[model samples]
Target: MAVSPAAAADTDRAGTGDQRPRSRRSGRRRTALAFWAFTGPFLAGLAVFTVVPVAWSAYLSFFDATNTVTPLSEDFVGFGNYTRMLQDQAFLDSLVTFSVFAAFIVPLTFACSLGLALLLDRVRFARAFFRSVFFLPFACSYVVASLVWKMSIFNGVRYGLANAVLDLFGVDDVAWLFNPDPPWYWLVIVSLRLWIQCGFYMILFIAALQQIPAHLYEAAYVDGAKPGRQTFWHITLPQLRATSVAVVMLILIAAYQAFDEFVNLIGNQAYARPPLVYLYYTALGTQQDLGRGSAGALILALIIAIVTLLQGRLLGFGNKEGR
Candidate 1:
């Protein structure tokens, strides 16, 4: 009752086919394991450097920790820090100031970036040159830029470039940083941020705009659509939706975490301190109130989270329109 040759051949082919799939599955599993093994170090490092520090900071926010030689010597005062933060007038002022700064900086940066990106997108000659020129500021160190603005541009009445220009126009010397007025100082700070940041965002928008199909614009032109209306309805707004979200989020976070500019332009000398700057001064300066500083940092983080959620909701709403 031996099997025929044809039947034996069929059995062999079937066995090989079955083993092929199993071999593929085993290889895939090995590949996955190897990938995880390679990345395990990075994941561990991230936990140690990023996650642990965040958890520690949150935990320390509950204590009356100080920068003194003995951090453990400070008493554990649960929620006392938060309570004082609620009562602190300066903390409240910083919140308002930061809010105002975000309100102005975000829109200004996005609008200017979009405009510049559009302008650059239309240019044909030396486009790379213009892009490099615009984006150069983003590559510059924030501290150096801040110092330059403080000394060279907004220095003071006697030696600042801005004041020199004002003098030519018969305007008197103005206190750029010293002024505590409602909008003037904020405006100047926001302007400097926009100047530095708009270029980076412009490049982002330019990249997005380039991804859009050129044929769509040509088709619209063939159908008698004007450049302005076509761009508004078809090319510009729709293509930029995701990019706009990213840019807004970045600008929002940067605005909330603003420290270097305030530190360099106005120093920790009391007059012009944003929230983070104030927090740094509080945690390290005279009072050495680590609890208050932690509370401020936590509050700022919460505000950013809430705003990000709101923006996400708005983006969802916008995407619902078939974008």
Candidate 2:
């Protein structure tokens, strides 16, 4: 049972197989190192910017941390801030404002985007150009758009585009964003949101509509189904349910987080302050009530979670029943 020294030497040299390149494992190890090298900074930033801030805010929610969020300045309050924020009339009004905004924007954006997608899907020439035209607004900053809407379009003067149109109709100059008695500002806000966002969601619907199997439509057509209404309701609409849910959810979240437009269009008004705007004045404004703001932030996060979950459940987003 004698073994050659040469084989043992070869086994030691190869490690696993004599024919394999010696650098393969090292190359794989280097590849893994490179992957982590590329991704490490992003992960670190997520921890520092996203995770730490969120965790710290949640921690500060239970404390009296006004004027300073540092650990040294915190005084234990144990849900007092949450209770107070829940009772605050301004905060509750902000929630109601968020609800109204969401109700107006979500359905409108969904419908407009889906309609645009359907129309674009039918276009045979210059489709990409048309899509880019519609989607170009998505690239514009919200602040810039809000300012343009406030100052140029609905600036409440005869020189403004809206007022000029009114001038055509022999109508008097009307203050759009300035008048809260009739709340005409809602028109400006909602229209601006729809113009900027509908294109992006239209692209989503376009992608989803393209994902619908042509054979399904063909099969429906073969079964004597009518083309427009019947085919759309039975085939196109049902196929788009997932994308519709996703679009609605994104719109819902965006609507709740509305701040820049509301601030620019309406200013620091009491009428239409959404929760983030209200919470901003609480935490970072002159009040500096970081504890209440943090509590409100957590509460808003919970509301977003509950709302998203409910929408998903109602829409059968995760359901396997039909799909």
Give the number of the best model, judged by TM-score: 2
Global Cα lDDT for candidate 1: 0.77
- Per residue, candidate 2 scores C-alpha lDDT tens digits across 1-323 of 13333443444456544335766555445555665677679779999999999999998998898798874544888989999999999998989888888889999999999999999999999998999999999999999999899999999889999999999999999989877878998999999999999999999999989988999989988899988999999889988877787788889888877999998888667888999988888999699989899999999999989988888888877554237
Tens digit of lDDT per residue, candidate 1, span 1-323? 14443454455555556567777555555655665577669779989998886677777788888774234635777888888887887877777777777788888999999999989998989999999999989987778888788778886666789899999989888778877753356656777888789899999999988887788788888888899966577766876777788788888887877888878777764445678887888877787877667777787788778878898887663353226
What do the candidate models score in CA lDDT, each in turn?
0.77, 0.86
Candidate 1: which pairs clash? none
Give the range where candidate 2 is weakest over 10 consecutive residues by summed lDDT.
Answer: 1-10
